[model samples]
Target chain A: MAEQDEDSLIGYDPLAWMHRSDFNQDSRKAEVGESEVDSSTELASSTETASNLEIDLDQAPADASEPYASQGERAVLVLEPVLNIQNVSVLHQHLMQMLSNFEAIDIDASGVTMIDTANLQLLLILKQTAIGLQKSISIDFPSDKFIEASELLGIAEMLEVDQAASGFF
Target chain B: MSARIVAVLNQKGGVGKTTTSVNLTHALAKLGKKITVIDFDPQSHLAVSLGSVDPQKSGIDKVLLEGVSLAEQSIPVRKNLNLVVAGPRLQEIEQLTDGGARRGDLLRRALLDGNRDEDFIFIDCPPSSGVLVANALFAADEILVPMTSDYLALQGLSHLVGTIKKFESALKRPYKFSLVMSRYIPTRRISKEVLSVIQKYFPGQILATAIRETALLAECPSFGKTIFEYRPGCRSARDFMALAEDFLQGRMM
Candidate 1:
C-alpha cells in the first residue's frame, strides 16, 4: 500500500500549488474587519488569558474528555482527524489546557488529517499568544493530511511549516 | 524618500516570479537600496523564500483592505530589506465585492503614505491576471515580467501586455516594465532561440541578467532563506547581483 502511494506521487510535484498565482477581480473590497492593523492587542490578551487558565494538561477533566500529556515544559496536544466547529470546542478546551499549563507547546498533529478555519484560527491565536508569552510552539510529527489542510488554508506557518514535507505531493 | 514600486509580474506559473521577487529584493538591498517586498501572491512564497513571515502573522492585505499601516505589516528581514507577508486573509480578494475604486488605490495609498523612506517596493504578483494583479498594475511604476523559455509561457505575453495596456488606458498613464528571462537553461538550444525571439519583439526591454536553472532556488526555500543567505556561492546569487546592478545602471549592458 505504501509502495502504491509513493508510486502515485511520481511526477506529482508538491509545490505545484505555488503556480496558481492569480489575483481575483474586485478582490480589493474583501469584507471582514475594519481595523487598519491586525488585532495584535486583542490576540495578546487572548493569549495571556489562555496561559493564565489553571487547567493542567495531565489533569483529568470534570467530564470524560481528552487529556493533555506533558513533556518537560512542553505540553503535547494531539488533535483529532476532523477539526470542524462540531469538534472545535473539544480541541479548543485541550488547547487552553496546554497553553495554561505549559511554557512550551508541542502539538502532535498526526491524527489531525482534517481541519477547518476555526481550528486553524485557534492555532494561529495560540501561536501568537505563545510568542507574546515567550513560549515555543512546534508541530510534532505532522501527517500528510495535516500538512495539506494547512497549505490549503494558507496557514502553513501554523504547522511551523514542515520543510521536508513542504514539497510532499 | 520615495520608493519606486516595481511589480514583478507574469501570468504563467513556475517561471520563478517568487524567486526573482525575493532574490531581487536581496540583491538590491545588498547594493544599499532600502527595499520592501510585498508578497502580494496569496501563496506567500515570497515570505517562504526569505523566511520572512510568521505563520500567524497577517499580511499587507490587511493594510490594503482593512486600513492597516505598512509599519504594522512590515517585518525586517535584514538590515535594509523589510517584508510584508501574504496571509490567508488575502485569499479573500478573490471573492471581494464591496470597495471598488478605494480598493484600487489602497496599495498606492499605503505605499505613498506609509512607506516614505524606502528606496524601492517590490510587489510579488501571482501568475494569473485578476483583481489582485489589476491592483498591482495600477499601483506599480514599473512591472517586471518573469517568464520561462517555454513556448506556452511565451503565449502569455499578449494577454499580459493587453492587460497592462488596459490599465494604462484606464488610468490615463503608462506603466513601465521589463522582461526577466527566468530559469534559463543555458545548454538548451530553445532557451537561446526564445531569448532572441523576445529580444526581437521588445528591443532593449529584456533585462541582461538571465537566471539559470538551479537546484539552489528550490533548496533555499525549504530552508526558509534567500539564495543570498542560503548558498551565496551559487550562480543564482551571481545572476541576481548582475540583475540588480543592471537595474541600478538601467541594465545598460
Candidate 2:
C-alpha cells in the first residue's frame, strides 16, 4: 500500500471515529452470541467520512489524445501503448473522424504493449467501415500485442494480418 | 499453473459480493494476472459494474443453455480481465427443471471445453441458492465469500456454509474456502463486535485486509467503473490493491 502514503491522499482512519466522546461503550454487547447473519451490504456508512469522499463522476476525456498525421489523403493513426475499454471510445471517435475526413487510413500500432477485445472490435469495425466505403484501411507496423490479441480473438484474418511475420507464429 | 477457478458467492444479497468480484479481479489483472470473470448472477450486476450495459450481450447462458464454448463469449474489458456477461436468458436457467443431473454440470462442462488460458476464473454468483449458483458450485474449485460485519450477514454466512458443507459431503471433496470482510466500519461498535463474533467461528478464514466502508465503493458501479478507475488514489482503491496482494500471497486460511 505504498500508494496510500502519497502526499495527495487525505488520510482516513476507519476506527478513528469510534473515539468520539458521545459514543457509549456500555451498549456494545453482541445480541447474537452464536447465531450467524447474512453477509453483503447495500452501501457504506454515512458517518463523517462520507463528506471527505466526494468524487467527480463526469470524467469525460480531457483532450483528444489520439494523434494522427495526414499523409496525402490517408490519415495515419498512431495507437498508444495500452489500449482497453478505458480509452477505446476516444480512439473510436478519432477513427470515425479520420474515416469521414480521409479516403484511406493506416493504423500505426507498433507501440501497443496491451490491447483488449474492445479495442480490437473497434479496429475490426474500422476495417469493415473502410471496406464498405471502398477505401483502404491497413494496420501498419502492428505490434506483437496487437497481433497476439487479434489472433486470440480469432480476428487476425478479418483485420487482414499475417501472424507468420511475428514471433507468435 | 492451472487457473484458480473461484466462485465469488454468498446466498445473501448485497454484501459487497459484486463489488469485490469486479475490483479484486481488476486489481489482479493490473498485477499482470490474466483473469476472466463470469456473471453467474441473473441480476447481471457484475457485468454492469464492468461497464457492459447491453442486455442482449451473448454470455454464459449461451454456453450453458446452448452448449457453446466459454471462451467464445469472453469480452476483454481490461488489459488482462475478460468478462462473460449474464445474458438476458440467464434467468431462464433458474426456471429450468428438465436437465436433471445435467443441469448442475453445464458450467463445469463448458469450462472444460474452453481453454482461455486465464490465471483466475471468477464466477459472480446470484445471492440465492438456485440452479445458477449450483452450476457455479460445480464449476469452481474455491469459494470466496464476501461478508459484512453484521448479525444478519453472519446468518447468511452460516446458511451458505451449510450449503457448501452439503456439497463437499456429497462430492467427497473440500473447497478452498476464504472470507473477505467488506464495507467494514472500524469506528462502529457493532462492526467490531460482529468481527469478533465471526473470528470466533471461522478462525483463520478471514483475509487480513478488510475493505472499509466508503461511499466511493457504492458509487463506482453507477458510473460503470471499478474503484481503481473511479478513484485510483482513494483509500478504497488502496484497500482493494492490498486485498488483491493479500489474495495473491495466500494471506487467508
Candidate 3:
C-alpha cells in the first residue's frame, strides 16, 4: 500500500504552487518579447525588496582582492552544527572580517544541522560581497539543512548550491 | 463519508489552540475514530505537543507549499491518529505578497483527495488573521474556536467571529462554528461573568465541558505528550474526554 502511494507521487512537484506566479510573470515577459530574465537578477530584485533583513551589505569591503588570514593561506572555515538565529550575528561578523582579508574563502557546511532565515541572509550577503569584489566564495559539502533552507526561501540558485555535493545522488 | 475538516482557530494567542487540537483530536482518535491533525501553524506547536520536534519534517507546509500528498507527509502519532507537522519555511508563506487569491486556497485544494479516508481532519491554525489562517478558513467547513474566560479573550473572540462571518458571507456558506472554553477557573467570579457574557451572545455555542487551567496541562507539551499520555486518569484528561464527547454529539453549533 505504501509503495502504491509512493508510486502515485512519482511526478508530483511540491513547489508548483510557488512557481505558478512566476510562470505567469514569465509568460507575460515572453509576450512582450523581453530577453530571457536571469534568475540571479530576479533573486537580487527579490532580496532588495526584503526590508526585514538586518545585514547592511553596503558597508562590505568592495575591493577584497587580497587574502587576509594570518593563520594560514588556505583559510577553510568549518561551520558549526547549528547556524541559526542564536549565532547569526557572530557568524556575520566573522564572515565580514574574512571577506575583508581573503580573496577566496571555502566554507565547510557539512555539519550544519539547523539553519534559519537570519543565517541564510548572512550567507547571501557574503556571496553578494564576493561577487562585487570579484572574489570567490564557495560552500563545500552543503548539508541537507542548509540546502532545504536555501531552497525554501527560493534562494538555492542564488546560493549556488550544488545538490550533487550531498552525495545522495 | 469523507472527513469533516475542522480548523481549530483563535486569532488570540495562548488561548489553547494547540492544547485543544492535540487533546481533542487524540481523545476522538482514542474513541476509535480515524483522525488526521495538521499542524497548520508555522510555530508547529501541535506537532511538538505530539512529540514530533523536528521542524525539518515535511508536513502540511509541504502540502501547501509543494503540493505534496497529505497522506505521504502524515506521521502516525497515535492509534487512529495521524499528524502532519508544519515543515520548515512555513513562516515564509506569511511574508508572501504574490499569488493573490490562489495562495489563500492552497490548503483547500491540497486536502481534496488525501482526507477522503479519514473520519476527521483537524487543522491547528496560527494565532493571527494572516494568509495561513485564511487558508485554514478556506479549507475547513467547521471553525472550532478555543476561547479563554477573560475580557481580552472576549475582545479577541469578537474579532474572530467577525473574520469568520466575513468568510461565510464571501463563500455564501455558514460554518459549523463551535467554541470550547479553555483554561477555565470555576472558582473565580470573573470566569462566571465571562462565561455568562459569552453565553448571552452565543447561547448553546459553548461546549459544556470547561477545560480548567492546570499546570500539568501546560507541562505536557514540554515532555512532548498529550493530556491523555501525560496524565491518563487525571481531571484534565476527563475534561478532554468530555469535550470530545460533546463534540461527537454535535452539542455545539
Query: What's model 3's lDDT at B128?
Result: 80
lDDT, candidate 2, B1-253, per-residue tens: 5688999999888798999999999999999999999998888999999999999887999988888888889999999999999998999987665544477678888888644589999999998776777778878899999999876887677557645644553344568889999999999766876686567556788888999999999999998999999999899999999999999897863
Better of 1 and 3 by lDDT: 3
Clashing pairs in 3: A14-B66, A68-A101
> Which residue segments of model 1 deviate by more than 4 Å?
A1-169
Model 1, B110-199: lDDT tens digits are 777853588999999987665577668768999988879866666566446545643553454566769888899989766775675567
The native-contact fractions of the candidates, in order shown, are 0.00, 0.00, 0.00
C-alpha lDDT (0 to 100) for residue A145 of candidate 1: 72
Name the TM-score of candidate 3. 0.60
**Candidate 3 overall Cα lDDT vs. reference?**
0.72
By DockQ thresholds, what CAPRI class is model 3? Answer: incorrect
What lDDT score goes with residue B75 in model 3? 88
Q: Which regions in candidate 2 have their CA more than 4 angstroms from the true location?
A: A1-169
Per-residue error for B56 in candidate 1, Å, reads 2.4
Q: Please give the lDDT score at residue B74 for candidate 1.
A: 83
Q: Quote the TM-score that chain A achieves in each candidate.
A: 0.53, 0.54, 0.55
